[model samples]
Target: MVENKHVLEISSVTTSDRGVYTCKASNRFGADICQAEMAIIDKPHFIKVVKGTNTVLQCEVAGTGPFEISWYKDKKQIRSSKKYRLTSQKAVISLEVSSFNSADVGEYECVIANEVGKCMCSATYILKDWQTPLIS
Candidate 1:
C-alpha cells in the first residue's frame, strides 16, 4: 500500500537522484506495483577563443542530446563565410578561421544550447587603425 501519494516532489533534482523508484498501491483484494528510473545530467561548459594568427573557438560538452551552436560577431550572428568553418563532435566543437584581419576585431561569442540548458563564452580582440607610410 502507498503510504503517501506525493513521493517524487522535491525542490531540485540532481544526478544523485538517478535510480530505480517503486510505487506500491494496494486495494482490498489485490495489489499493484510500478517502477521507474531517472537520470539527471549537467550542461556543458562554455566555449572559449583567443585572438591569434589563426583563431579557433572551441566548445566542450557532454550527453546524448540535441545541441545547437552558433558564432556571433559584435552581437550579430555570423553567417557561413569563406574564412569561417565549423566542426563538431560528441564532446568537442570548434569554429576555425583561416586568417585574422582588421575586420575581425570585435567581440566574438560561441554559444552552445540544448533542450536542457545553454552556455556561452566570449572574447574580444581590438585592432588599431594605421595610416599610410610616408616616403622619404
Candidate 2:
C-alpha cells in the first residue's frame, strides 16, 4: 500500500521562491498529480530621507492586491491636513510635514496591511538647533 498523505514546508521565503510546484503520487495500479502556487508578501521597508528644514518620510511595500496604508505618530493615528500631506504612488508611500519643528519630534510609523498579512516600519524625528559662530 502507498501512503496517501504528504506535506511541504518552506521557511524564510523570498521573491525568487515564488512559483508553481507539483506533487505526484504513483502506484502500480494508478497515479495522481496535484499543483500549487506560492506567493510572497513583502514587508514594509523605509527609504533613507535627507533631513533639512522640512521633513519627509517614505516607505515601499509589495504584495497581492488592495493594501491599506496608515500613518501614526507616537502610537496615535494621523491624517492629512494643512500640517501633513500623505501620498501614495505605485508601491511607494510617503508623508510630508509642512514646516517641521521641535513639536513634530516623535516616533513616526507607517503600517501596511492586506488580506494576507500586515507589516510596519517606524522612524524617530529629532530636531537640532543650529548655532552661529562668534568672531572677535
Q: List the pairs of residues colliding in candidate 2.
A: none
Q: What does candidate 1's lDDT look like per residue over 1-136, in tens digits?
A: 8656657674687667778888888879989999998766666564333333446666676643577778898899976778888778767777776666666767778787777787887777664434221111
TM-score top scorer: 1
| Per-candidate count of clashing residue pairs (backbone under 3 Å) | 0, 0
lDDT of each: 0.68, 0.75
Candidate 1 stretches greater than 4 Å from native: 1-12, 24-32, 39-44, 47-53, 62-64, 127-136
lDDT of 2: 0.75
lDDT tens digits, residue span 1-136, model 2: 9956678888877878999999998889999899999877664444443333357777766675478889998999989999989998988788887766667878888888887778887877765564321111
Whole-model lDDT, model 1 = 0.68
* Model 2: CA > 4 A from native: 1-53, 130-136
